[model samples]
Target: MSEVLTTDMDRDALNNDGFRLSVISSTAVLLEQFSAVYDNYPSYLEIFSPIKCQCGKLPVNNYPESLQKQIQRLVNNITEGMETQRKPLVMQKKKPPPLKMFEPKIEEVFDDRKKRKGGSKEINEKQKLVHKYKKEMKGAIREIRKDSYMIAQVQFQEQQEKYASFFLLTLTVLLLLSMGYKIKWL
Candidate 1:
């Protein structure tokens, strides 16, 4: 129930700062009049009670009928306007693309052995090619690791050198200050 109320509030024009300001400004006069009447009769039901208005003894009795009618009209108009102005800003959900079916291509290789001869030579050659590819891949991976390690070491050395230079400069400045060299810059 609270969630529903919150969602309604979120969609309300009064929640918008600019729209709320405009509505407040437009109803300033009505609000002031309502406030004055409200001051006498704090309860909403009491304000509309005929008994309260009919009694000439009470200050609330002075409340005019026309003011009540006007307030009612203003409230009705504001609610109608709010309903008309509310437009859904949320976008519609998109439908996903249709699924596609992919069929793998099947192939048959014919060798001399399939007929009546030997195919051992071809099998040996293919195996050798596979081993050669595996070795090349391993060598490439090892070289990449070595290059990365060397780069990291170079960066570390550079950082160390920078810190060392800064330390030495600070030490020299401290030594000079301690010796009372009377340097103009110091």
Candidate 2:
């Protein structure tokens, strides 16, 4: 900015004081320009047209090349410095704590065991009922089998008596015919 002011066609001496004054003036000009452009970047882009400075020169067009270079250097320095300042993030994966270590040996264990045993008393009674039903069903099946065997034996004896009676009737008729033939009663 200081270089920009001393760089005016009318300004001959470019001393430190002249440079300081020019910088101050350039700052004021820069503020105005920023405010105008700060409304929007597109608005700033519009102001890229020749900006006139108080030195009777267009500020943007007549801006000293050295000052533009200095501005570029300042921007690069700031960005690089900020990059160095950022700390590297190390992500740490946390593992869950070992699952509830070891079961406690307490009186509750004995109490639960006794309670479970007491409940099983009812289960024993139900089991007894199941056993009794099984025994009764087995006895009924045995009685049915014995009655079936007795009925079959009676039926077999009846069939044998019928066949014997038929054989005896046939024998008596043959004996009568033989006696008639011997008496010549043909």
Candidate 3:
């Protein structure tokens, strides 16, 4: 077996085929040994049977008749114990309390009236302050708008002056050219 596995071949091919064949031969030997040991055994079925079903219950059908009956009895006893252990519910009649309207005391009402009078004065003062601030904000915004307008006017005037100067220079050049004056730069 070792000679058959270790022959001269490509390293990758040898590794794959050699490992596969060795595993297959080993599994075959194991299965043969297992079968020889259990083939004629009388309790082979009980030995190899599943201990529990897929749903986690004991495999009662796999067991002998007497054990199956005992398991059923135990299961019945456990279910009865669970049923008896539960608490019983009791029913009773209940009455809701009557509703009542809230009424303020005389002294509390007088105190609240006094607070309202003071609060009104404070509210008037706050309103006056808010009006003053609003007026100041409007004046500031107006001044900002006026300044931006003046800056825009100045920029427009500067651009107009630049174009006027350029036009005058071009006119002078054309006049000198028409008069047949040989300008050295030209």
Of 1 and 3, which scores higher on TM-score? Answer: 3
What does the lDDT read for residue 133 in candidate 1?
Answer: 100
Clashing residue pairs in candidate 1 (N, C-alpha, C atoms within 3 angstroms) = none
TM-score of each: 0.29, 0.30, 0.32
Give lDDT tens digits, candidate 3, residues 131-163: 799999999999999999999999999999999
The whole-model lDDT of each prediction reads 0.60, 0.58, 0.59
Evaluate model 2: give its TM-score: 0.30
List where candidate 1 sits over 4 angstroms from the true fold: 1-123, 180-186
How many clashes does each candidate structure show, in the order listed?
0, 1, 0
- Stretches > 4 Å off in candidate 3: 1-119, 182-186
Evaluated at residue 169, the lDDT of candidate 1 is 90
Best by TM-score: 3
Q: Considering summed lDDT, which 10 consecutive residues are worst modelled in model 2?
A: 47-56
Model 3 collision count: 0
Model 1, position 150, has a per-residue lDDT of 100
